[model samples]
Target: MKFKDYYQALGLERGASEADIKKAYRKLAHQYHPDVSKDPQGEEKFKALAEAYATLKDPEKRAAYDNLGQRSSGEQFTPPPDWQQRYKTDAAGFDDVDLADIFAAFSQAGGRQRQDMPRPGQDYEIAAWVTLEQIFRGGEIEVGAELPEYDQNGLPHRVAHVFKITIPNGAADGQRLRLAGQGGHGVNGGRAGDLYVVLAVQPHPLYRVSGRDLYLDLPLAPWEAVLGGNIEIPTLAGPVALNIKPGTLAGQKLRLAKRGLGNRDGSTGALYAVVRIDVPNQVSPREQVLYEQLAANSTFQPRAHFATGAGA
Candidate 1:
């Protein structure tokens, strides 16, 4: 099982306002509709956009989706025996079925043949892990996935499927790469379900991701934070010099515009460098004497606020 990122499908941020979601859906719907676009996969993209929007537009569905956070995509995930019982339908009298419901139903049915009607194989989601650098530089990924093949009566048998997926440059964490007709096999000549490989960027050693933006902790010496200067900073592409303003405080964030993740619209997200002041744990005799002398000479009272009765 793989997870789907509804926010990515609509090309919107996770924190995108409701108005933003609506605006993005309208634009994508028009651009990707098979009738309006010449893109080879226009119809497929359109369907996915609709599905993503449907899940996100509903607050109840969105909340449920968020609960399953950061699970590895593009890999096999076996649901618990009582998965269905845990996620029973709570929506009452809702005319439309959300994506979460569809996923739960598929897990319970396990591709069982129902009555005499031909049924298509259930759609599946797999998590695919990629690095922030990989998203910065678009490339292909090959992952091993266990695809289920259904028998004539809709009994599912597992098959090992090797997938080579092309990742889009600047792809966000919740974006999905759709692989058509690669999911569970069709039963009674019905069409095979689509496979959605949701892109999950692994946590980077240097950067933390929030939507498309990247955040990095920049450790600076206490002196450096107090008297800042030009410092070298690492980016996805290469290293660049950053001007650290004088009197920068710890925990203060400095923004590097358009230096983070890439987007489909040719825009990139900003990178935030958060200041972290480092202090030497130990010092030589000479250094200790110098520090003592400086402390005695310095009148900078850090505890002045505590001394005042304002907080108390």
Candidate 2:
């Protein structure tokens, strides 16, 4: 069988401490984890690293591996007669057995007590897209994911799971809602892991949100902008009357208190109506004549500062 050098795979020496082994595994695992890595061989490298760490992290497995003596990585070698007799395994016709499998058998034989010990499962995080309306009011959303489940032999397998998560009122964008004991299943008598649902607010057709504030574009005619009157504006709740001040300019914001998103602390955000003056596409002859009369009679100089070249 070809021998694998677990210490070499982890870039550690035979005499390295347990803390060093854990630290090295964590660093390499983060870099090569299949979900986040961009390397072409990341999956293969990650599996190798995991296998190496799995054996080295355990005292009994490490002792069994160390008994095999030092050999160059991938070099063909035979296990010592004493090592085979200790494990009570006949090495005859076992050439195809991988080095990892050999350690698995060794662990099964020597680490039965360790295997029965409780071990907590891994936690998982999933992103969920929520609508603005849902954020305004508490609601439920469904999400599906694959979680790990350990079999009778202590082998992990992926199992599909569906969960309905409750989104609380005033749940902010990017907030994580944790569901206790909903992640990977635990082994032995350990507790299951938690599932974190991360919220991502979907883009709205009529409103833009910042914190809890809502901004909506309010279009008004020239006369309405100049005359100042009550106008109906649409909110998430329904249409509400908004008072427009006379001579309101474009790009001005009119605030409506407590009309935005609700907060968990029983507070509410403000809604701003952004003013936009709109003109008719076509005007009648009488309207054109009236416009002409107003233009000739009005003394308004909107571009008066341009004449002084001060803002040119």
Predictions in order: lDDT? 0.73, 0.82
Q: How many backbone clashes does candidate 2 have?
A: 0
TM-score of 2: 0.61
Over 4 Å off in model 1, which ranges? 1-116, 150-157, 308-312
For candidate 1, lDDT tens digit of each residue in 178-293? 88988766545778889998887787999998877889999998778888899999999899899988889989999999999888888889999999998999999999999999
Scored by TM-score, the top model is: 2
Worst 10 residues of 1 by lDDT: 89-98
Can you give the lDDT of residue 90 in candidate 2?
48
How far in Å is the alpha carbon of 307 misplaced in model 2? 3.8
At residue 177, candidate 1 shows an lDDT of 76
Colliding pairs, model 2: none
Sliding window of 10 residues with minimal summed lDDT for model 2: 148-157
* Native-to-model Cα distance after best TM-score fit, residue 133 in candidate 1, in Å: 1.4
Q: What are the per-residue Cα lDDT tens digits for candidate 2 across 168-256?
A: 87798889979899876665678888998888888999999988899999999998999999989988888899999899998999999
- Please give each candidate's TM-score: 0.60, 0.61
